[model samples]
Target: MAEQLAQLADDRALLGRTSTAERVSDILRSRISEGFFPPGTRLSEDSIGGALGVSRNTLREAFRLLTHERLLVHELNRGVFVRVLTVDDVEDIYRTRTLVECAVVRGLGEPPYALDALAGSVEEGRRGAREGDWKRVGTANIHFHRELVALAGSERTDEVMRSVFAELRLAFHVVDDWRALHEPYLARNHEILQALRAGDRDGAERLLAVYLANSQERLVEVYRRRVGEDG
Candidate 1:
């Protein structure tokens, strides 16, 4: 009985540790998306661990997770840093998203689950936008599109789309005016949601394509201008 109780305690401890690591990862990822840790910003294990009241081991695990998501780069001997999104990265992600997302929509015939998920995300984004929470808005925006892509019913596509959005979040940080960059899209997202709800998959796909293309262009311009200013 004592042995069994000890084993249970060990399992609880492990679960608690894992939960802490996950929470650390989520907070760091959100900060990265919000531009708190811009491209090339080095993350010090000791400093970050201290700030978050986590152990160095936990912080390292969180860093590894973010690196896998492409939001951080782990350099040999140099340490981990926030990844800078190159123009090539932006273009490639946009192209891939367009292809996969459009295909997902095309194949989704009256997928109420997907439609409802998208709508829910859009409403959340609207609320976030109204509350002036650009970071939350950005997250909701990704969630909406991610749900739409999940309609493709391909686990592989979902994985690819997740990476694409991580990279896109880096690009979003380049915009100086966060609200300006995201506000205009809320209404467009609703339009897409309405079309999807109405079972107009083709129309939704077309609108999404245009919306993504325009968003890419705007983000690219913002990145260029910001880079120029920094230079």
Candidate 2:
């Protein structure tokens, strides 16, 4: 009986180790997205590993992956923390997104095959927002923009936009009121969809440009306000 119990314990432990890595990744991602783990919060391998019941090695691997994606930054002596998005970072990301998304719209002589996907993502965003699932709302928002960019007909552009979008997700974390920050944009998204559906690419492009600029300003304001409060 003791041997059987020991075997059961081992099985549970193994299962936990596997599960812990996935759970830890999700937890860290959500916290980063929610601004709970802000820029420059030192990530101690031993502490996080213990907290998540993951091996130090597994945690390090996770850090490395995020670091590669530019979501986390690693310093030689200071350790890893969430990447801080600066003013320049915001400008660059917005510029790239605007350029890419505009090109995507221009490329559309008529609505591309991906219009349905974009519509679906908008609905997903609305549903997530209605359910008060801000995280899902954020995910849907990213997907919607990503699908728009994909219409540019370049795989490489999509890849670059994905990376930028991930960093933007981190920036969105700075907003204090999640629903207030994201809810207002849902209708604007639907409006863009309406224009696109009518094959009004020029109008859609103009609206997208304006929307992205406003979003950047709002995000920057929130970040500055938060930083000032903390200081």
For every model shown, the clashing-pair count is 0, 0
Clashing pairs in 2: none
Error of 2 at 185 (Å): 1.2
Q: Write the per-residue lDDT of candidate 2 for residues 1-231, one digit (tens) a residue.
A: 233233323433443535654455545665566555666677778766665566787778778777876788998888887897776676677888888887888778655456888999999998998798977787888889989887777899887887788788877766668777787789889999999988888889888989988887777778777755321
| Candidate with maximal lDDT | 1
- The local distance difference test score of each candidate is 0.78, 0.75
Q: What's the CA error at residue 171 for candidate 2, in Å?
A: 0.9
* Clashes by residue pair, model 1: none
Q: C-alpha displacement of 127 in model 2, angstroms?
A: 1.3
Candidate 2 segments exceeding 4 Å error: 1-38, 46-65, 229-231
Candidate 2: global Cα-lDDT? 0.75
Where does candidate 1 stray beyond 4 Å?
1-15, 19-27, 50-62, 110-114, 229-231
Compose the digit string of candidate 1's lDDT tens values, residues 8-70: 234333335455767777677766765667788888786666555577888889898889888
Per-prediction RMSD in angstroms?
7.7, 6.9
How accurate locally is residue 107 in candidate 2, as Cα lDDT from 0 to 100? Answer: 77
